[model samples]
Target: MEVDYSDIRVIGFDADDTLWVNETYFREAEEKFAELLEGYETKNKIDQELFKMEIKNLALYGYGIKGFMLSMIESALELSNNEVSQATLSEILNLGKEMISHPVELLDGVEVVLKQLKGKYRLIVLTKGDLLDQERKLERSGLSAYFHHVEVLSDKKEKNYQDLLSHLNIDVKEFLMIGNSLRSDVLPLVNIGARAVHVPFHTTWQHEEIEEPKQKTGYITTNSLANILEYL
Candidate 1:
């Protein structure tokens, strides 16, 4: 229960999986799409190919409907060998958009923890995704009141972490980032001397996986979102 509150003015959080059940919905959709292509490709191959399309699209359109739509199109095209009908691609795009349009659901105990810390800390959301999509999710989650600011960026690199703190007029040491995804959330923040807590989700997106463990930062890992409240 020894959480550090010393000079920690701003607490940054990664939105997906941390605050709400995001990846599950996306995963479910991907699996459904994979089933559609089962006749053309093996499940693992479809997943691997779809993963590559997503990563490539992330660079082009960043996170959100735009990137996801492109991935759907690319995956469908790739699976069909450029012979897929426009009708099929249109259906896939529609499905993807429908998935994104769904309401956001806050994770277990997210409300309890946010209520506990809202008054004491400058809570900010620093999530990487489609700007409008992320914002819409935040608005629907009904937890936006607890956050002072919400940042939707293309990526969560070390530079993004450093730049955000600088723009916020806060020192790196005065911040603490809490969320899932070691690759996006923990490592970059820790590199700048900002403390971080890693709440590992059971199924992270392939692009978001950490290739190696970051053992040096002393970053705390929690099994559940509720467990985070005890630390804070």
Candidate 2:
């Protein structure tokens, strides 16, 4: 089905993975974390347990590297029967710091697309993560000036997008969202009567994976960020 975008007045972009490299860093950190806890359990088991701990603590710690670090620590303790060494715990903290301090790496054509769409429509960032960390990344990305506004949401459910659109005084029919996660960035908006474009990144978190139906509508998918320019 051909979707229409002639009515879109505001475009929302998901920051992580969509504009810059994010989940890749998390994958690297998880590998290191698994290595650190290898003595307690197999790498496979450690990975599984760490994922479980992250999901379990989502409500308490929320998202981003800090929460991931806490989950790793808790998983280490549980895996080790509360016998994990203090040194290992300290290393986990260091891993989080390293990730937090890592420079933001923007994907190809991110600025180009933003520049092309800047004055043509209202451009805003709609993403979820640690507020400080996301802000730091935006500062480093050198793309902040292109955005009219930036929002760090707690979660990206349908209601969250609806509330954000309402807060921005944007009508549902006049909004478009672009990002990599179908779960967070695409489906929710589609369900809320807004438009979305999916730009797949090479790597994604397990939590973001979804089953694409044989027949679906309400959104479009592109292979790269550059492709989104065609629709706009």
Name the best candidate (by TM-score).
2
My TM-score estimates for the predictions, one after another, are 0.92, 0.98
Candidate 2 to truth, TM: 0.98
Candidate 2, residues 89-149: lDDT per residue as tens digits? 9999999999999999999999989889989999999999999999999999999999999
CA lDDT of each prediction against the hidden true structure: 0.82, 0.93
lDDT of 1 at 131: 83
Clashing pairs in 2: none
RMSD of 2: 0.7
Ten-residue stretch with the least lDDT total in model 1: 210-219
